[model samples]
Target: MPSSRISEEITFRKLEALLAFMETGNLAKAAEALEVSTVSVHRALHSLEEGMRCALFRHEGRNLLPTEAAHVLADVARDVLKSMAEGIRETREAAGYSADQLKIGSLYSLTIRTVPQVVIGIKTRRPDLQAELVLGSNADLLYKLKQGAIDAALTGMPEPDPEIESIPLFEDDIFFAAPADSRFARMEAIDLRLCRDEPFVSLGEGFVTSSGFMEAFRIADFTPNIVMKVGDIFSLMNLVGGGIGYTLLPGRVRDMAAGNIALIPLTAEFDMKQTIGLSFLRRRERDPNLLALAAVCRMTRIAR
Candidate 1:
């Protein structure tokens, strides 16, 4: 086979044949696995080997023995096939071709209010659409959106990534959450500097809330004595409610505040606020489900 043909003609079907033959170790079994004739499998392998200018198999009696080259090609073929499959799925989603299924990513904090309202609104508009919600931290959701794993995400305004288009939904005020009975909780507004010596329970670093919490400390010109770092907001809030340590959270979390936990608004020169938004790949703007979800986000009044 010519090099030009090898470069341009090595299709996914040939790679699939190569992988199936290597795994099954027999032309007949490979054919059965691929739902093709044994002759077709043999021809595919032979053409692939010829195209690559290498021997991929040795035949003994009726069985075909795979060479080391075959094994290497099999590995590469697996990755190629997997990536191709993912590409197809992503392309279909971007073209608004899903079978009435919409994948949405969101922050765990929004599950209580923002997420449910958006889901309800989408269902109301498109009765046939099924909204699948995936909850994670801001970073995780943004990563998924960029990877084309989710149709859209409801998260904090991530540092600008040119691939992502963020539609600002609402702004949430940051507050200091402490044990209800504590002296700091009794105050109308907590001064940022007053908590300099207090133990703090914070969300792990990748979270948008964590960044805001750290920024508040930075503005106060003091390093908080962080005692524990947790993955989720609810767990961090529970730790504060149990008197483990105080934590900084947005106004949205106030609804879930336990009776033992007090949420005091922050009064400081640095306005500690989180801008929540709907984010998706800029290329996916034409997707119907994404457009519908965006409409819902725009119309729905997110409670704080």
Candidate 2:
């Protein structure tokens, strides 16, 4: 249809005035209801009637009487206005702007302490709020944050990125982890060179711990013998506990497994630290929901 033929002059404000006038059946009352001057109300209805290209009112003596066409348009306008408001509200919520629920992504290890503390603190502060935890590796979590699949992320902070906003919560040292019954458990600290020939079960490619594991060995000038690679942290920890092979882990997992696992410190030369942080899109830095989450993060730092 041509734009000229369509009611291009029709607008929500006109529809609102039409509804008010239709409800009150008085020009002064409609103006008062809309918090506008009587002249504004008259102009709105006049434009609406002209846009509709029909007789919406008829003058009877000194008063204006609404025609049946006006009543029909009022009913439809009411529905349209209500639906528009609902659409805007739902759109905001779908974009993670809702205060009723928060979607938080994190490294699987942080679920042991840091993630839980932040979740609890935020919930306590916002009593009506609900939280969802999405656990993955560091790479996985940061990818989700960028994709807007999660509202915030708790993971090992990456080197500075322009698009991401990172709030460093704490530094968690990487430890040389092995079975409790292993001979290395009795040692004061782990020397990576001694374990170069030792078979290792590692958290696979995308994990932050996996990168730290590789870096420590690289600093020690040796390549670790790889026995297996797993997706999640828990599985790697289980492998270590079952005497499968030695692996590296962050301090957050120190007490996660039973006494079967021992977390020994790394030698000075092989020292590596994973900085855990809360991260989101830099554009959403001032969002109320994100600000509240940041506040909780500020107070919920987990001690290694």
Candidate 3:
């Protein structure tokens, strides 16, 4: 494949005209949006097509229909423009050009339970620290932390990496949750063998909780017959609420009970608990802001 021409060598003014043309679908509207004459917009797009050596649009009445090449180029151009806007925003934020804000990332499961508590605790301890919370999956949060998009994050025990360091905050055990009217709900403690034949609802493979639950089941020497594989704790709990199937969820869920699902402790061969912790890049250890955030994480715990 041939290397593309340098962005500087190509005129961004023509690219902007093409983007405006795509959005408005008509020369008059495109010219209005670009704040230029209809003749100017037409000339810019014609010149852009000349540079690219392709027909970008087809004329039908007053409307212009994008060709396949135009469609593909428009997608890339949209992303490029969006990223440029984001870069400008982030640069402004980092240059002390706006109100200072601390970015934080946390797992979706903890967004309702552990995260709010930590935010309140941070405010009480450091009233001046302006904070912005970003909720994502463990992998997504880890990626953000590594990229310096987030100063610190709260998640379950993430697999170790040389650049990342995890500090233990709390241990959260898994328990069986079932509808109050279900047969399993009557039991205070559930045996793994007894639940082997029961219908199971659980998180799928992408989540940390599901990964741990699968390993625990294997270690306990039982293959669970999962009837439904959901994405988040809320949906899994809802499935349990409707008595779809019993599910194993982290003890942190005790903090946010939305339904009449019985929480049963498990005394099986393998003990399952997700070690909730704070993760940050090892290089950021000495940073004062991150250090203070780490201290705040240590003081916060799952509500009993």
Candidate 4:
């Protein structure tokens, strides 16, 4: 094949089909994996062989046997595809195309305050930019950030991962929530030791608040008599109001507290606080949207 034919006919789609077929060892399975018809996969593979001017496969009755050359090409194709994907991502970052839209992830608890302020600050800086917010638990947000599903996240300070860069925005004190008429609600500040025997309503394990709650108990050297483990903060608060059990949350949630629910500060000894921050992959430092969002998070003050 001429060099020009190789350049013109060897498209990325054909290379992708070749790789899929090589991996699956069956044209129909490759077609299903690629969400294409079997005929299309066969056409792509044929086109690739024609462009290379080499017999990549041979027919063995009903089976297609890959030649040694096919294996070599498949390996090279994998690297080429990965390089192409990285090139496109870097190009978009450099060209500022991604700056027009930012994808942000955060804990649902922050959506009521911190996340909104950060979004506003970013929009103030770039009026044409769009922001999409995804709210989930701490573990979920961090996983999505690592997977590149979201450009950045506002969450509890995650453990130091070399792949991730975190900017600490502010520290929030965790307060105890109880029914208004409860004896604990009458106190100005309550120590964790004082409530050791009280039934507790907890946020489930994956939540950032859950870690802090556990830490408080650990510091006090006692396990909470937890009666319920919930997915969201509001549900926990509601349960507290209904006199089911008490829970712990940040001071920022005071505004959303129901009249029947009372949020009491903790004593200095039980001063459990979570460091809320902005996090992103260290490799994405140069991405304009991520940089813009990070800038806003650094300067904006979230109400305590």
Best by TM-score: 2
lDDT of 3: 0.78
Candidate 3 Cα RMSD after full superposition onto the native fold (Å):
16.3
lDDT per residue (tens digit) for residues 1-304 in model 2: 7755767779999999999998998999999999999999999989988899899999999798899999899889999999998998888787777557888998888878777788888888787878888988888888898999898998888879999999998988888888888999999899888886899999888788888888888888988889899999999999999888999988878878659998989888888898888899998887677898999898876433
* Candidate 4 local lDDT, 1-304, one digit each (tens): 5555455568999999999999998999999999999999999988888878899999999988889999999999999999999899888855444656788898878888888788889999888888988888889989998887888888899999999999999888899898999998989998889887789999888899999999989989999999999888888888999999998889878888858988899999888888898999888788777778888887775443
- Give the C-alpha lDDT of model 1: 0.85
| Residues 253-285 of candidate 3: C-alpha lDDT, one tens digit per residue | 775654588788887565688888898888767
Worst 10 residues of 1 by lDDT: 1-10
Give TM per candidate: 0.68, 0.77, 0.63, 0.68
lDDT of each: 0.85, 0.87, 0.78, 0.87
Off by over 4 Å in 3: 1-99, 301-304
Q: Which residue pairs in candidate 3 collide?
A: none
In model 4, what is the error at residue 227, expressed in angstroms? 1.1
The clash numbers for all candidates, in the given order, read 0, 0, 0, 0
| Worst window of 10 by summed lDDT in candidate 3 | 92-101
Model 1, 208-244: lDDT tens per residue? 9999998888989999999999999999988998899
